[model samples]
Target: MPDAVMPREAAAALKGDAALPQKCLDCGQRIGWVELFFSLFLGLFKLTIGIISNSHALIASSLYSAQDFFSSIIVIISMKYQKRPPTEDYPYGFGKIEYVAAGALCLAVFLGAITLLIAATRVIFAGVTHPAHWVAFWAALVAFGANVMLYRYSECAGHRLGSPAILTTSEHVKGDAVSSILVAVAVLGTKAGIHHLDPLIAILEVAHIIFMLYHMLKQSVGGLMDAALPEEEQEQIRTLVTAVDGVEQITDLKTRAYGQSNEICVEIELDPSLALAATAPIRNAVKDTLLKGLVKPSTVKIYLAPAGEGRALASSRQQAVREALARYYLGHVKRHHLEITPSSVALRLTFYSQVLPGMRKQICAAVGTNIENNIEDGTVSVSEV
Candidate 1:
């Protein structure tokens, strides 16, 4: 009963972007390795400087770098999850977990910001602050440069992959770039006689981080909750589906996003006179049309029903019943006989080759359900001949 999620925004983004040739499932692997080493370098460099100078600002920057370090690890883990093929146990594939990863990254950013805010506040009110050493200045500069490079790399790759985890964490990494810039300013400002500038910049960066995290959560939570495709895209899909030959009208359409693509269920109404064989190809055409430029992998289901105003031609009893059977199976015919009696009906289905015993019960149950729906009162029997 759960709804489906579609990554619509990324699909839209992909429209104007023609340069990124590598948005495959394995996109984050290289990004992870890149961020991993850089974050480790940045975190260690800043932590060392912070320890030597006893500066909370540098120490907190070190923690921010450490957060990036962990995010890279999470990215690698989530990438593995993203690459998992759909199995019998997981028919929908493992793409939705990327949104979960994005959520986790968002939470980490929020917690880091809050922690930074609390620490900065204490330092602001705790009277005179210890002066940061010259080594702290070089550390801030190095962190700033490294963060800028990481931000650019993450942003481009995330957009290409349509991955919220990559995008959100990249933005978080961008915040670190901003943080280091402010840290550099704070150090220089304190040296230039504005002693309060250090903590003030920290406060500003905290506010910015909170604002960014709020937006990331707002966007990501919807996807995690099986958000639908946007109205415009829905209309676009509607137009495409109905344009296919033999689709008289579209009665209903539903979409759910899983990873980068959409899972769609379309209800198509056709003239009742249309043969089941005719409907099958129409369904396939509609699927191909909708998926041509779609960004994500999709599973599409087509439901066919008679058009509301269409009427069937009158036929003899035997012909009508056989026609119904043919329509249900889309004219994939074998030797079949329908036996009717008051309060009971039986169908003998003769297959051309071996009938798998496992499928025999399923076929019978399906035909039984169909009979119950149509005739209203017969217990149907299914026998494979």
Candidate 2:
């Protein structure tokens, strides 16, 4: 028989840390300010140049900058909701808001792509009458420099904080960098009398937007459905749990991400011979081990089951015991545990029996002799599974 296990919530909260959320908030703010500053600066700069120099490629890139600038505001706003503690009305917290913000950014990218492509197609057919002025080249160069800086900072903070929004925004900024380079090339091409290449650069910008939008859409949908963590991370979690002493085997394990962090649930099998008091420390140790390896969970559930007969390897030995005993009319045996010591063995169990109080002694004698084979010193308590 296995001892009663500790409550999973108490065990998971043994560390009592929710560092991931706050970390994400700080990362978002740092990256958000960068997003806003550069977008506003470059959007106006390129838009003004595109109109003055008659550069369609620069015009397309300006629309993208405007989209990025507004999406950064969304990212900053979403962080406010994500920073709140779990409330009674919302047990899992507001991690999904970041995902919503991500989706919105992707939508913004898609819309900008459409707008850019439409303007590019019109420019492609219209034919360039004159090359862009030298000022357009300098504008693209400056925009590329700004995007490169934003991408580095955002990529660093995104990976460190494990924020999908920051990472997505970084990709957006990278697209801007590439767009700026293409605009620079298009201006040079047009100056050299190849007017068609200008719209080609704008078409390339749309391709980048489509690629990023696909990724953002997939992740946002998966996050809402409580998708599992990556395969590598899941394997790491499994290895940590298996390393704990006295843990016979993992019966079940599950992990899912909410806002910025993840939640884990684990059920393990333990030796039947261990007493209830002995199992408590092992439970705490396992929880602590998990805490070290994984994020603080929004809801973690852990259960312990005995290893042997009723649960472990019942296929060959206990299969016959369960079927024959039920026919012999003892009861439906929920679980049976046997502990062996030098020269003696003990049996402890729980089951449901309909036998009257008057027939209890007869049933006990029959249970000991027929099923357990030596239930002399121990007792069988009636219960439900």
Candidate 3:
């Protein structure tokens, strides 16, 4: 029997710390809380300063901050639910909740962008009474600094935890940081006597938000739909599975993304002569290979099929017959060939025994009976060489 040994790294990643460790969950919660606090503080500060100074750009940035605050809450909730183990009612666990949270975040950002766009348009129609107050510029600068810090922290935390929600939130923070810079520039331009620059910058920020919304929405919807992994990754999985020693052919391979990880299902054909006990190690080998390779699926299901099942070709059936004969003959048989037809199979065998008066005929009859009993309808011819 082949050893069903799994690589240490593969074992750890598939069954150990890489699969949502409690420490990582705790870190995700802390990061979410930190983001929520900063988003709330900055949203209120920017909104207040934007209103006091009539800075449209700052108001738009405030709306983005508000969205970030909402997204932070959703992230925390997703992390809480995602920690639950698979149960009878939900066999796949709550990993998909992260995608739902992401979709909601995209919707919230879309609505905020539309609202900011309308408000900026209205402000553009109405003339500016005066230049934006210098205080609003300071607020924008502060928001920029805060968002930059949050982006750095959340990005690092996302990578460490391997949480898609955290990573998406980090991208949002990065966008907010860029928007803040634009807001600051608009405020300075307004103070420098460019009357329309503030509202124009607000419209520009709306455009950027919409752009980000497209990508976030695509990813969230893809996850919800159980989209397949990229073709390159699928091909890589095929290559690894085919490299296993006993795998004859891959009949089926499937993959889909689930939260931060992926799920894979593969069906492979093995030699018909292999005992049921022998297939266990082959399955384990395939699983270990995938986990050790770049695929690293969180869930792997392998189905084994014997050669010559269903639509298997004539050559496969011939090979199965040969294997069976080899087992039955032990070391006595020298050479053998098989011909399979729609209704019957014919096998020719050459043995290492000396010819005697009717020994060849008796040997042929015995082998024919054995082949017919073991395999399908078949005739065997034996000769001494």
What CA RMSD would candidate 2 show? 8.8
- Extract clashing residue pairs from model 3: none
Model 1, span 1-385: residue lDDT tens: 1112333233433556544444443456688888888888888888788779655567667766766776787677777776666775777778777567657777876787788788778877885367666677788888888888889889988877766667766977887877787778778877887776776776786676667667766766777788888898789889888788888888788887755556788877766656445655776787777666555546667766556533222112234356446644543335675533333455677654455666655665666666566664435566676
Q: Itemize residue pairs with steric clashes in candidate 1.
A: 4-256, 4-257, 5-256, 5-257, 6-257, 261-296
Local distance difference test scores for all models? 0.67, 0.68, 0.74
lDDT of 3 by residue, 1-385 (tens): 1122222122233245555445555677798899899999988998899989888888888877877887788778877786677775797778788778778777877887898899889878887777678888888888888899899999977876566778877988888888888888988898788989999999998887788778877988998999998899899889999999999999888788877567888878887666445667888899878777752326777766666743354455556566556554665565665434333455666665554537555656666665566555433444443
lDDT tens digits by residue: candidate 2, 161-183: 55667777787788888889989
Better of 1 and 3 by lDDT: 3
> Which lDDT value does model 1 have at 21?
45
Count the clashes in each prediction.
6, 2, 0
lDDT for model 3 comes to 0.74
Candidate 2 residue pairs that clash: 1-337, 95-259
Q: Model 3 residue 81 lDDT?
A: 84
The list of candidate 1 runs beyond 4 A from truth reads: 1-27, 51-57, 106-109, 243-249, 310-385
Q: Please tell me which predicted candidate would have the highest TM-score against the true structure.
A: 3
Off by over 4 Å in 3: 1-23, 294-297, 307-385
RMSD (Å) per prediction: 8.2, 8.8, 13.3
